[model samples]
Target chain A: MKRFFILSSLLLLFLAGCSVQHKVVPAGNDVPSQKYKMEVVFPKGEISGIMAFKRAGGNMYGTAVNEFGVKVFDFVLTGGKRCKLKNVTGFLNKWYIRRTISKDLPELLNMDFAEDALEYVNYRQNIKYKLILIKE
Target chain B: MKQATIIISFLLLSILPVKAQTDNEIIANIEKASKEMTSLQCSFTQKKQVSIIDEVITSSGVLYYLRDTKLCWEYKKPYSYKFIMNGDKVMLKSGNTVNVFDTKSNKMFSQISKLIISGVDGSGISDKTRFDVSFATKGKDVVVTLVPKTKDIKKMFSEVLLHFDVQGYFIKEIEMIEPSGDKTDIILTDRIINKSIDEKVFHIE
Candidate 1:
């Protein structure tokens, strides 16, 4: 299921280019803490970083690493079934700049080559180990 | 006026002749020299490199470290940046920009800082079990190198080199060379060791 969402995001990310705003809304009750580490391989490239989700009242406090592994923005996750990370890392000149992502998306967002692309990116360029734990 | 003063200072320093000891003398002398310092406060200059960019960025600032694991890494010249670590969270200030970081984000950097302070304080280095030592002398300083016999340390720095002054066992400089070849060199100049450093040095403004 996790792999499925990753694939879908990759597909939508490419087709939508810089304007896609798709995401997955978790089915479970509100979890205060979730340690989420994702490696997304787009048909065009790779996305890897850490995200720590702490339930702050109705919102989530998030901290993440940019595509370059540099520490970027830390912002509050508000509204929506799933909050898309919109320039959270806040790097001025990153390919992932202005990108919005969520855990759920439609099938058009999933591409068959996404897994392969992720592997290639991991092997060819950047290696990322990002940890984000959503707290309850 | 401030910029001119800096320029003139650099001009004078550039002409200063390099004075280093021979390899053997450095090794022998450094081996016998030892210090019982609890803390250090001094100014430093750092040159950082990003291989992908193939360029070096130089910065200068004041540094502080306690015998305990506390350290303040600051950059004041060229660019003003400071990283203050309390527990796992970090407050990173770049000039007028300020940022707060969650500790869990980067284990590698967090661990590296712990490793650096440990090496600087000597207590941690002496207590570590997997390091093999090699010594050499260079002009007025003794350079002692430590290679990790274990994999944990081999993950970051292949070897740690400490340059000690001949007059005092004081470490004048330290170089931590990562396995990937990227290295961080910290030159400790005009050190005022154990000179009642302000307790406020640890606070992030």
Candidate 2:
């Protein structure tokens, strides 16, 4: 009886971990190349920058640059489902932060790429990221 | 052979000092102009090019600067945002929200303030201890190219180029090149110098 109870508890823990993982759905990557105004709300304060996305080879590649023209990060979204981070700014290049962004950015991409505005919030980290397409 | 060597040496000696003098003369002119201007207002256009993605992002804004440390950079297109710095205090407004904090409180903000303030006021640009500064003539413009001597600045910018018109001697354009090969050009136009700017422009309190 003791052995069975321990086994069930371990299984329950595994299931809980799996359920916590966020889901990224595959969507069309037909978004045009454009620059989007980006605002990131951190726990302490907020930082703003610009995000630019270019679609090529059925994949969308994006780069974020700060207002001062510093490169923040680069990412590629495959089929709008999986996000692969190519580079990140030195301060935010941590593994945990990269993991969170990979999980969150695709969701923003999935939301009708043609939309003028999009936002994603990572509640676990309490970081809000917003993107607004800048009309030429 | 000795006669030819003397003639060649004479030409080199005569040409080198003139080139060196021209660089110093340009720097002196810029420094002098920066000191005379008490206040400045201008419209600026910033273009950032990312070579990796082959994208160019353009942002235009108005800049207000007071001689010492106060500056207001307001973006007016596609999005609305403002960064106002008055001494140690910095105010950032996005949309309707405003956050005021001290430069000492945030390291990043402090660094940004220093860069923008120094670039606009042309203070540290002439500091030989900080950068290996050189000058070149680009048609009617005098271009000063600075290579960072410190590792901290080198990490941010591989090279910085400041463009000045021969007529005004004020900084007309600034180009910063990053280690990643991306570059940004800020061009200032319609400059109004020595005009009285309202003190309220710097009021973030």
Candidate 3:
């Protein structure tokens, strides 16, 4: 009875450890190209704009504009890995802004991560930024 | 009577010198007229063309300028956005969000805004250090072409053209051609000049 009790405890511990380990899932690559109205909430302030994206030959090209119809930025993502920022307005031409947007784009566009459709809310550095995709 | 005759002769001689400089007469008159302009409010329609993609985008907005420093561009249709520049500070508002920053940190924006303000007022075109200016006449319009001399400006735009109405000396259209063959044309209409503009309109809270 003593041996059996020890064996049972060891099995429980092993099972618990296995259950705590997380499984990593790769994002889906089948998301269709579409236009989305993006709103970014930062620590200083928030900005809303329209983004038009097109995927061709496994590459993504995008252009964004402010509500005043001013062109903000144009970028290209090749093979889902390499990123090239073609043009950007002076106010948003910072390194951190570019890095943050690049990191969050895939997740926001539903190209990465398995999640619900149409809306995504992400938190970074205690600031919450949300992206809502509207179908035209 | 002799002293009065001498004074009249002196005035006529001064006027003759000015008249002899006919090449610069139009620009001088424009500069003189712009000095009296305190504020201006106008509506503008802008059309941008991207040659690579073969796409043309059109937008309309209202523009406000107050003498030297303050300017505002507000868009109402399709969506609402505001860009206000007051001295060294710039503010942009879209929807409920407002982003404010100092223009000193952004040299490119500062330079561009300054050029726009000067261009609208029709005074900076004579700055030979910045642009090579040449004038031409096209029917009732006086067309002025400015080719950028600065490297930073030349990298973005090849040339800028301003069209003025000869009778009123009012700017009617502005065209900017980019190095990449893209062009942006802005047409200003319904202009009201030298109007009293409330100072509160320049501030963005």
Candidate 4:
């Protein structure tokens, strides 16, 4: 019984440590569509791309393309909280990568931006995501 | 009748090889033009179709290339971004921040840089060692399809098609098809070849 309790406690700690936590607020009512220059940095390297987002009804949909013009990923942010990845490039379809993107992008969508340009940065799962507003 | 039949057979055999020879000649002419060209300035329109979202995004940009190895690809519509490749170095500018990378140190970037230059200059498209190339003549355009022979490129792109004008032997359009059925088509227009492009255009800062 003691061993079981200790193992359960350790497992809980591990799970908590691995969880993705980001402070998010409700998205503002602004332009219906925008474009950003996105960069995703991992320990090994960085991936640069362009992201286009459109808000319709209550959900925001985004698609990203690499500098070489390859489609990187597509996602939908619902209610400024729920982020569902619609598709990911074959090169970045790993489970861990998907989890981090799904967790971090919603928080990014919830943040406010300047009228002309602004930079937003977030860190999750040992990955850095930066989005710079380029167009509205 | 026997002599006439033999002559007809010989004529058909001679005509059959002409198409293959024409394809090779066209490729050679493009290579020769690329070799002689020193610089090029062009405007391009890129259209990407996202299969998952069922949407099409259109963007326009300008491309500048200097002989040997210098290129600047800049996006001006809907958003602003710049990619410049000078020799073994690459620079990317987004908003206010700029990042520089050494292509020699990064294999992926090195391949991409070379691919862009070759695609624009029409030099390496017919590389028998790197790609399985096929040609189809349609109207005044000769479409060259290149299937990647390397696993790394094959993983990213299923095939690439380059459309060249027969009269000028210059590339008109480039279509890259991904494995997931998504594709990006870039149409080059307002092309001015062998013109003096300012060296400052390729400057990193």
Chain B only, TM-score of each candidate: 0.68, 0.93, 0.86, 0.91
For model 2, fnat equals 0.30
lDDT of every predicted structure (CA atoms): 0.52, 0.81, 0.70, 0.78
lDDT of 1 by residue, A1-136 (tens): 9999999999887877533112212224244333333444444443443333444445444444322123333334454244444323222225443233333211112223223122112333233322322222
TM-score of each: 0.47, 0.84, 0.65, 0.77
On TM-score, the leading prediction is: 2
What class would a CAPRI assessor give candidate 1's docking?
incorrect
- Model 4, range B1-205, lDDT digits (tens) per residue? 9999999999999998998798779889889878888888999999887643445667789999998899999988756779999988899887787989999887666766776777788976667787898889889998889888887677667888888898888888988898867788999999999989899999987
- Model 2 over residues A71-91: C-alpha lDDT tens digits? 777787888799987546656
Clashing pairs in 4: none
Worst 10 residues of 1 chain B by lDDT: B48-57
Worst 10 residues of 1 chain A by lDDT: A104-113
lDDT by residue (tens digit), candidate 3, B1-205: 9999999999999997765575387787677767877889999987766432334556678999998889997876445678899989988887797878788976655766766786788876777998998887789987889899988777657888888888877788888876645677888999999988888878967
Model 4, CA-based lDDT: 0.78
Task: List model 1 lDDT by residue over B86-153, tens digit each.
Answer: 66666666547565655577554565566666556543335347677666668876566888776656
Chain B of candidate 2 vs. true chain B, TM: 0.93
Error of 3 at B58 (Å): 2.1
Off by more than 4 A, model 3: A1-50, A53-61, A65-136, B1-23
- Pairs of colliding residues, candidate 3: none
TM-score of 3: 0.65
